[model samples]
Target: MSDNQQPAKNHVTLLLLSVMLLGAALVFAVAADAPHTLVLTAAGLGLSFSRRTPLSRTTRSYVYAGVSVLAATVLQDQIFPVDTQRFYLIDGRYYAPAVIFLGIAITFFEQRDTTLTSVISLALIGTMIAGNSGATIVTNPRFPMTNGLLDYFHFFYGCVVAVQMLAMLAVLPHVDRRVRLPAPGRAWRWHRATVFWVSVFGVAGTVVGLRVAAIHYERLADRTFRDLFRVYMRRQSERMIFGYEVDLWRTVPPRTRADKTPVVRALAAQAPGYLRGRAFVRYGRGTWSSSDTGEHLPPTRPGGRYAYSVFRRALAGRTPSATPPPAPRPATIDLLPATAYPLGGLLAPGNAVEFELIADGLNNSNEGALVPREWDVAGGYSLALDDSIRDTAYQGPAEPPTEAERYLDIPGHIKEDVARVANTVFGATPPRPGTQGRLAQLSRFFEAGFTYELGVKFDPAGKDPILQFVEQRRGHCELFAATTVLLLRAQGIPARYVTGFVCGERPPSGTYWVARLEDAHAWTEAYVAEENRWVLVENTPASGFPTTDSASGVVSRAFDRLLVAWQNLLAQVKRGYVAEVIVALFLGLCRGLGRLLTHPLWGPVAVLSLGSAVWWLWQRRRRRRLAAADRLLVPTRTELQKTLGVLEKQARRFGVERQPCNTIRELARRLESAAQGPLRDALLELLREYETLRYQGTPPAVEAVAEFKAKVRRRLAAPG
Candidate 1:
């Protein structure tokens, strides 16, 4: 390998290979109906990693996976429709997101921008997007159009993955060479090992890493995620908020993100007050969890506006009193929930028993919390209640007085911050009387200095998100609610965490109030012994609530309604195969096997046939291995030409297709991807020699050519 012995092909060929792989992947993703999210994930990660930050292929792959999940999964509302409006912002100016997105992608398409870092960013990021997006487009309600379509889809995805792996493998060596000096001085054995290991895990790792990447792309490309980059402006106003659950503690690799997909619709003339969802009795660390000790009411269809079920006084923790009847307004709306089980239940501004409520089924906790049964929770449900009031008490189980202590308890680690905030807000004032007075007192915390913001991230560098939020005086509803709960608990007011939607908007044509994911919120519910029941307390600043313009845009609302309608259509189309043909075939095969075994007459023949098939496979594999070994030992007619053919066949077998335009150098690189160890390095050296001689316009002497071919044969025969 002389310095002047240049390879015939250049980076252009590699560029074409990389682009082909990317295009193939995107084609499959888009055809699978997952292009929007997959493209967003790739563009977002690629744009970020393409900046001058130094990172490795392996490191980039892992980072892409982790950050994509965090940004796209836990906070889907904030991340999706990355561009909702016709225009997106750039340096405070508006531009079409599609133009900007496509522009950048094309810029990187050419290998002119290719570097060790940039190329890996493209390859690895593309892979994560393709695998994750494709996974989402083909699951659950997405039954195959015909029998075995899912299996065929999976096979297609596998082929696309194979293409990506082959391209990356081919480009990896050049990427390695561009970043390192050819020779290194021999040092201590340990030091040599360090250098060897530090060559970015050397060539062998590409194979291992190829399999390791795309491990969790499915999460980022969540089925519910909407990459509304086209809706950039609409996306701009969308913010991350709490989902259906009352989750307090921060999560790691969250189980799910906030979904904007329409889950349920409440059709009513007026909006439901705080559609009370989940109520948590216990709080620890930074999380809130539920202790659901209640009863499951079977589906009840009572006569004359039949109430689906009733919330007994025992569950409300209320002694019989002059509880006002729910305002008579029965409305119907089908729920299109996000999960298998809709976590939170509706509160239609009615007394515990006033409004009739039932899904396919309902679960009532002793504390008045409700959830739909495991699966059948969609379609229409009926409820009657007044929509005038926004403030409502969330109740819990009635039991031993000691049980109330749990609400007053605060995580010991944050007791200091809690005390500080309580003092700042309450300021030694005498405890307020009744639930209203307590709520008035709690509202002071929001007034004191805090500000409501949606684009907030947890700050782990200083104190926990609790104190940091107080010190900084800025965050979303979750922060406002969590801090308010902590403030009240510090003063001995029994408070529990609550989460649900604040429904307000009605669709253009429909009477029902539509509660989009952005409206998801958190508020504190405190128990006042004097009131004999829990009462709602909204401590979030007024700014936290959606504005008329923000929440009730006619176009945005229309688009949302249409999107929901479309989603509902897809979910209910149900035109695919009614039964799993694969399962039926399996069962039939099982029955045949059983009959054959039981008959005893045919059992021996079956076993013999199985044995013969296995033996045939083994023999075929052995023969291939033997033929491979023999070829490596003997050189064919032409010097170097025979070796190239063998290498080409090996490369093709590994899914590395060669173009007719490929030069010998391009062929060698592709072959190197399928070959490894001494065989790979030997190919590189032999190619260099042939190029050097060809450049000089002189053929190598017969003896030298013979010796060169023999040397290559020896290297091929050598074990890795």
Candidate 2:
């Protein structure tokens, strides 16, 4: 590696290492959604290909041309790490092409620190690769992420960069000492010519990329790629410039993001019951108001002691059973953000008997309302619920309210319509005594034809909104609860509406249920005359009531994982982790891109196409300019003019040139004076042929001009 004599081998190794390093950063950048990968890629490619001479320069340039493209894929995990559009501003369509041109502009300097250039390029490339997928990517329950350290793609790249740095400690040994036509001057000219030709092909590549990208994204946007060519540029700008193509994502329908935003994080010994927020006693005009519940307010000084009273009243006059009751499930909940609702919620598990909030900072309203003092607080409210405490066969309240007009009344106007719904939902199935019977009935009604949609709107002046709900069978949680209350009340059953969150989402890796805005729900709670209890009734379709079922083994495993996650969080919080995390992310990006460029099919075709285009264009530019001497006026008017200009420019180089005379006779006199013998006779013959073709439009063989240029070059070089 320290041997300067091995330039060819060294260049090959550097190319491989450079591509690998760049590929890793690019992949990680895309995964992390860092947008600046575009700028770094263009600059890196431009700086790397600054070789001189037509053939070697173009070949070297092509080595870097298609390096920006590798593999085309849409990442499967629906995570987008880009928080802002700052990356897009820098990697704009205009900025990308400009960067390429500017990179070529950098090649205007020949004796550059290739080592420093590679280092800076890789460093910025590393930066654009940016942040880690977060620690979660490594330990996520999904195993695909950390497989084979594919996420560590640039380890090989880093090793090479380090080795090259060691060599840079030896840079002074490599400078050439030639005096006349010094190596630096020759290098300057060579570098200029190299970039000029690279620019030509770059422009062509840009035009072709743009045209193809437009056609593909516009006309073929909806269709399949059909071939590899179509997808080679997936997530990249048309080959014109290498930037992330935001619109090239596969057309998979996105998962609904409406409710993924979490509003609460609650931990439980098991999935806790529906956390109750508010309870409403009166129902009319399609609304449930939490007023006049006919119950005394519970005391609050002793934190959770007052809550047990609310539960005891519900369990009033209950009888104990022969079976042993299950232990109380304990849980804590925190409000993640301030919400429209007045309070967070009270934990209410199935058949909760003696409810107690171990933590305070919250208040309870007797009608099942638990209001939090602050939206986001360090301390969360904890409570216990006895899921196994059945209604225990209650036989109605000891002394029912004696008033003829109960304030907790359902409106009489909607009784007939609700009864009709009852007939349809129950279908002659005789009602059983306890709270479970009514709960089962309402559950069936919701499941029959109604859907759990959040978009169903209602008009206040319409013909009985509850009636309309039954007829149309479309409403949200509110309507579902109201309809259930009305239906239960129509059958002479006492029921009220309850609003709260249905916190039942238990992840495999978590001991908690996350509640989001979409989880805010409303349901019915009916007082069982025979059971003497207010039991929860889930009336919304698919909103099944909570159940307490968790094996000890599963709970233990989840607790262990939670502990590990907490420790990981602590590790990440330390200051030293910032650098390590940044490096890890860069490696991951490079690894991903490395996979793409190393693809068996896409990689080779890209390299070949780029090489061929550059090679052909360099040759063509050389032919047209006759650059061995210099380029003269470009003949666009006619064939005679084109041939004459070529001949005149070449003849002038040997100091025997003559041109621009209007008459053929006068031109002949001048050429005869400027030269003599074979050169003069040959020039006159060519002039006569040009005159013939200019006026007569008599087409001459295409070879006449080529044969003329060959003769002129050969004679001009004959020891003049």
Candidate 3:
């Protein structure tokens, strides 16, 4: 075929190819979570099938637009679960709109030359890359990254997409040249060797990259967090910018420790949990700060014994570090949700419970929300309690509380009505006086009237409304915890609010779903002396536990097991083992069928028979058409004489023609001598052949005549 004389490929062929690719993309989208694969595949397909343009170009451009939309949807779904201050999905609401614009912009130069096209292509790529990268980094500002590895993955992902785009663009020209149709009877064969090798290498490269990235992407963040922590701790800032705080790890001590009492030492021996942040005391209008007082230590000598029911909220869903069981366990560790603000102070149950707090930065100090775990103090020394700093005072043995200190240090605003309700719930007679009585009363009080619930409708009027709820005898976990802490504190017991998740849910495979936000809770802590330590007392009514089941439970578990099998089957199919086996079976069956269709002897006979059949049909059609045309066609002698007369008339009409005297042969010779001489060559050749055949009475072969007829008909059909 001539360089530009392509086969007649109309819009229909381009449409068919576009549909096939779009169908493939749809299948992928339905089966996989990542839309990028489908999107890039569609883009590649469009580039390959872009020969039938206007139609091909239009199809590709629109499909790209569709891909952009699908990708946006996938991205949106991926980001939906991460609750952050910024909109990570669209990376800013404008991101989707900007992408749409980029898609449209690419269409402007769809028909341009290579250089101009590349310019537009570069612009589109640049806008897409810069906009998306900016959106991600801007929206998720990494002020103090907990993991450096995660950042690296994020950065690498951008680079990979950019590289993939460039690679695809670089190969577009070669791909486009391959899909074009050829001239009649010259069907273009795609180079099987080239297509096969390129495809195999491309797929292998992709598989290797994805496998490597998957193994390492998630862990990068965690590793980086660890590395940066080590670096920040030892290195001084080369240049500190305004408002830039020191890295979180560098600011806090490596090992969190607390006042060392026997109880603290015992708890510490169990395990080293993240020491929840230290307690805060002074409160400014919108902010809360901690007191400068050091850790509290238990007192030595005792006048009156005291007991503290420290209620710790669970960090639901999170795995706990392995720790040994506590000695003389104070009571049941009632799990509460994170938001519940249990009343009465927060103190774990133990005669001399100690706290080892790894200070979480100052921003969240004493917001009364920290994960509370059994303390693991360094030494088996006694602790001295300091009223000013509730966290810790002295490092020694447990002590007794003075009567006035235990029962009369009521904050001025403890509503009398709230105290009355507390009296009604626990009674003036302490339940198991010093420790036992208080525990029993607390248990009895909660069991009688409260129910656990995931969410509590908070009252804006805080304490006053809580007091009213005490009279009502029913409230959510927060209300119960808040009321308990306040009442216990009012009655001379030190108490504080605590936030954490509740009990872990065990599933079949030794896996547990920790407390979720829905399990956020609160409870109370009261001081006692029987065990010579503070005891954690859960008083938030059991009725308040969330009623809904987790998605990771029974139903989901069964579905996931089934899903695993399906995935395995699909994996086999994608890897081609299943398809290859099927193909082999089909080929085995087809072996006999092929013999029937093309046995050595039969194949030659069948081909000859078909060719004879076609030749017969063509001869019949041509003979009929030639007979009709001949009836209309004058004899050659008459046509020559008429042509000579027309030339003579033209000479006479013009009155100047030297050609008027020329014979037919002379006129023909003169026409042949001019630059356009080839115009008469075909006729001359036809005349010579005709003269030889007719004068000699020689019969031309059917095939030769047929081909000659076709050529003559085609030549005569052209417009002059």
Candidate 4:
């Protein structure tokens, strides 16, 4: 309504907007792993323009004291019990303390005094050191802590305090006198105080900027900021790129080739068969990707006899009989740490009748690949597939399903080459028109000519990798699988490229199959129009894939089992099951303690002993801080010296100087002689207050001290 009120309203609006921006940046930093620069810039700009009012010094001090009490209570296990098994929540415990200290520092900005500012600065610096130490102890187990670059815990708490301090300095009208015209003679004093604080903030900003730049440079040299943030946040799974991309591409050497990295272990009567991860329908010049944009199938319950019968008939290349058979046998699988992506579920060659997964988020893709919604450290699922009809011929309808079209996708660049190769291998017109005949002919072509070699490299920039494989007669499983899928598509058969792990080395006990990273294999699956099913067609030579005997060693197998157990433990921890167990154990212990304390005769003695011990501990800790108490008292003595100097300067203005050995009361009497009326009364009052505070153990209140100092200034300014 009024012109004077307009600027204040604008400042308030700017402050709200800045706070919102900073809050958004904080959320983004947490969720999206945003760059530190983005968060820092947002926070800095927000503080620069904000004009929110700060809490009064006394109110803020009370809040800080309350928070400190709460922290002490929680640390003592009186409020929140500390469970070592559930220690992951320890970082969250730092929040209340950080907020309290930051609130106190911001309140100090309202008072334009360098002494208070320095004290707040020192408090914040001390808090940073303690917070970082606690964080390091909780997050890492190793001792002799090394100061690493981009310490998220330190940076986060430090930023919170710094932002609040800057916001208070920027917004509080009392902090910067230039924002308003002051009274005559008082203008220079206010200007000097303003410059001093601004310079302090400027120096702080320069130091922080240099530290951030150093961190950024260090992170850039080793890895990206996103990766560093992931490590900091302990979200390692987010960095994993699941799907066919990593499996299909051979940019790096296979893990198995370098060293045996166990992926899965199966406990079954026979070999668990290939474990399919994902399927791709489209084939480009040198790449393969899924083109079937089909929605995931709804989760199904465990099927009984009827489902099994139907599945058996479908896989057998025959129409289902009206009568149903018995339920199929189940096979169990244990996914390992080396298996980076989710294994959807353990699948066999034929249709799965039932799946009992010991995990959640399982879904079946349109291309028949099983994918889980999230990554799991270790999980298991049992499924029963219709193995009886797996190798049978098709006997379904003539027309193919609409979904089959995507599986026939072939890039235009290699379409001609694919057709020519298919024509030469199986003849332009095959001996049989069915899917089985074409598959048999393709298998013979690979077996007779192509050689299996992991070392074979293909130049993607040149001709298509599949074409190179066909011409050179040498390549790995990926090239073989890609060529097979392309060849099937060329022959008017719908086929998709599949990436998974083949059944690897089986131990002497023969209880299970161990699938390692080296067991990662690729193949093709072609859809049969008659059977209304997709059949796996392996074209890669058997010699190229890992065999059951490749992995063997008593010590190695024992270590693998240990690793599997460790992985399972981690998975349980992630799922909160371990925390639940720990809490249950803790409650049981507390109940037992209550029973023990209720014993008739010893109960009173036990209680007394416990109380005495606690009291003794408290006293010991209090006495331990005696040296620190002496150090803290040094600042109060310095402040007294500063106050005496100010009083002497004011007396000089009145042209009155008592002897050096004169007491404060004698000086005050001399100053009173130089003055009269209210000025004389003020000098006597100020001297009496100072004498009581200095001589006695009791110090005057902050407000009382401020009032006495103001009286001295007013008296010096008045005309005698």
Candidate topping TM-score: 4
lDDT (CA) per prediction: 0.52, 0.47, 0.38, 0.55
lDDT-superior candidate, 2 or 4 = 4
lDDT of 4 by residue, 1-720 (tens): 211121232444235334433433342233222234233434444553453443334666657745653443233222222222222323322332333234333432343444234434434443343333333333322221322412565566456556645654544443334346545477787786788698667858866986788777985755775677668555535433335553334543534444465566766666666767667766665767664433343444333111101111122234454345344434434334455533434444435544443333444555555554432333344455554444311212234533446667788887888889888878986366578787898999989888887666667567877777788898788888888888888888887777777775787656567776677778777776665566678888878876778466888777766765676554444334445555668889998778868989778887999899999998887665543344554444435546767667656767778564588888887887685665556556766777776566665556666676676677656724
Q: Using lDDT as the measure, which candidate wins?
A: 4
Candidate 2 C-alpha lDDT tens digits along 1-720: 111112332343334334534544444443344335434554555455544311223445444432322100101111111222322213222232222223333332233346335433543344333322332233222324434443543443334334433333333233332433335577787876676556555655665676578666964654553454457544233322111111111121322564454445565555554666566665556445554233432434422112112123343435565657555455333222222222434434433433323232444344545443322221233344444455312222334422213324656786666677777765646644445665686676678777655445555567677776777786666677777777776666766666666676666666556555556666777665554455566666653232222222576556645643553333222212333455568888889767757889877876787689999999887665444222332232244555677656645544654532246566666666664556556666666766665445444555664565565556545523
Ranking 2 against 3 by lDDT, winner: 2
Model 4: ten consecutive residues of lowest lDDT: 304-313
Query: For candidate 1, which ten residues in a row score worst on lDDT?
Result: 86-95
Per-residue C-alpha lDDT of model 1 across residues 1-720, encoded as one tens digit per residue? 322122332444345344543554353334333344446545553554354322333556555544544333322222221211111122101112222233234333323335434544544444444333333334423223322434455445555555555455555544434455545566555575665455534444654454456445655555434555446534433322323344433432311234333444555555554666666656656567776657766554443222233322323455544556455444433334443323445443323443233334566665556655522232233443322322356445556333667777888888886887777666766654655565786676568777876556665555667777778787777777777777878877777777777776666666446665656667777766765666677878887763322344678678767766754442332111112233357689999888887677788888888899999999998767545554543232244555556545645655676564677677677766764655566656766665554444454566766786676567656724
* lDDT tens digits, residue span 1-720, model 3: 212223433333333333433333332222222244346445644553564433234577667756665544433333321222233213323333233333333333233344234433443443343323222333222222313323453444434444443444444433334346455342323454555567657755775677678677869867986898678644433311111111111111211122100011111112111112222222222122343332223322211111111222211111222444333322222111111222112222222233222111112122222232222111111211222222211111123432324222434464566577667756766542544565576568767756543223434455554554565565565456556656665555655433333423333543222233344344444444433333344676545653223336577667644543454343333223344565567788788657755888887876788789999999998767545544543354334333334334433332323342344454445445544333345544543443443234344455544555555545434413
**What's every prediction's RMSD, in angstroms?**
23.6, 25.0, 24.5, 19.9
TM-scores of the candidates are: 0.40, 0.35, 0.32, 0.46
- Decreasing TM-score order of the candidates: 4, 1, 2, 3
